[model samples]
Target: MIKQILPSEVVAVDVREDPPEATLFPEEEALVAAAVEKRRREFRTVRHCARLALAELDVPPSPLLRGERGAPIWPAGIVGSMTHCAGYRAAAVGRSEVVSTIGIDAEPHDRLPDGVLDAVSLPAERVRHAALAGADATVHWDRILFSAKESVYKAWFPLTGRWLGFEDADITIDAEAGAFQARLLVPGDTAEGLYLTGFAGRWLVQDGVVTTAIAVLR
Candidate 1:
């Protein structure tokens, strides 16, 4: 379980049942009927994890449909994101205005695949990697940075109607407090000057599991 304390309100959550196997949706969601049986099952797991996450909100779960920009809308007024790996399923949710946006993700804790930093980390962050040659610090920092970028996107994308690459935001991780921070670099097509001053929460990487959450604030 994790709690994301923002300036307005806090979002609390727990990781739920993870699919025993990898799940993937068909490229053609509209023609799901023609999808392979295994593909259909994967889609079901995605929907189920999403719904279960929303259950933590004050709003009752309803059919959540994706908008043109890929944001989700539920009958109840809330926004969130959920992701599950072979062994973990996680979600983050918040009510609008009162709360901006929330995203949660889980990954297995193995040495991050080599060279992913090029795609997922900022130039300055990459320097940190260079400095921590043999320390656990470097590896965990890499994970937190990757996680922060993902959370920022989930929080920003729905409201802005645009997508942000990992390089679009600069991230800072506070290891002792178990929290992280982010700042907009390009701001791009997002709300101008919409600075992400801070993101506070807990993250754990143990026994081959890595989980984190982020909640946007006022």
Candidate 2:
């Protein structure tokens, strides 16, 4: 499920399983044992990714547990984030020393559902974003917005010990650079208000799948 994209400084991974394979943890099995087939399959996908990561670090293949609010926490000093969807799964790891905030997201290369854009973006955001990224933009605006929010959650939770909503961060895609710049509207008391220094985003569309990464500045 993981393909190392960034060097050791930033680790990125991707998975290709409907509903993903790394969602299950040992503790969740009992609760979900009687769940429908679809849910069980999804859990298997997520746990596979998590277990592979633990094994690589020589840890047991037990389920990767989540703390309050579903934040994944591994034993000992490792810091990372887990992301899985209907089509893929991924995890980003940075040895506790250098990595500050890391986030990865995968979205299908499809059009936004009706009214979905309005729910995610305000009128001004929609206008400013298009101006910020004129023509020749290959990436879709809604996907960029959704991916940016996911990354923010992954990167911010560990640093701040707090939760942020989707409206907390905003993004402007830079087509020329093949990336996007994100601005943090509200970092909250976590990390002493981690204002947006900047976000280095990398986007890829492979075999009709769209995956993007937003590694928070150190």
Best by lDDT: 2
Which TM-score value belongs to model 1? 0.74
Indicate the residue-level lDDT of 217 in model 1.
58
Q: lDDT at 89 for candidate 2?
A: 67
Q: For candidate 2, what is the total of clashing residue pairs?
A: 12
lDDT, candidate 2, 1-218, per-residue tens: 23433445655444675443245656868656898987776566656665666556665665566687877766565677776656676776665666666677767766679887777775666886577446536656667666666776776677777777666667676655656666667734556465444456766656556666755445
* CA lDDT for candidate 2: 0.63
TM-score of 2: 0.79
Clashes of each: 0, 12
> Cα lDDT for residue 20, model 2?
31
Model 2 misplaced regions, further than 4 Å: 1-5, 11-13, 18-25, 128-138, 187-198, 216-218
TM-score of each model, in listed order: 0.74, 0.79
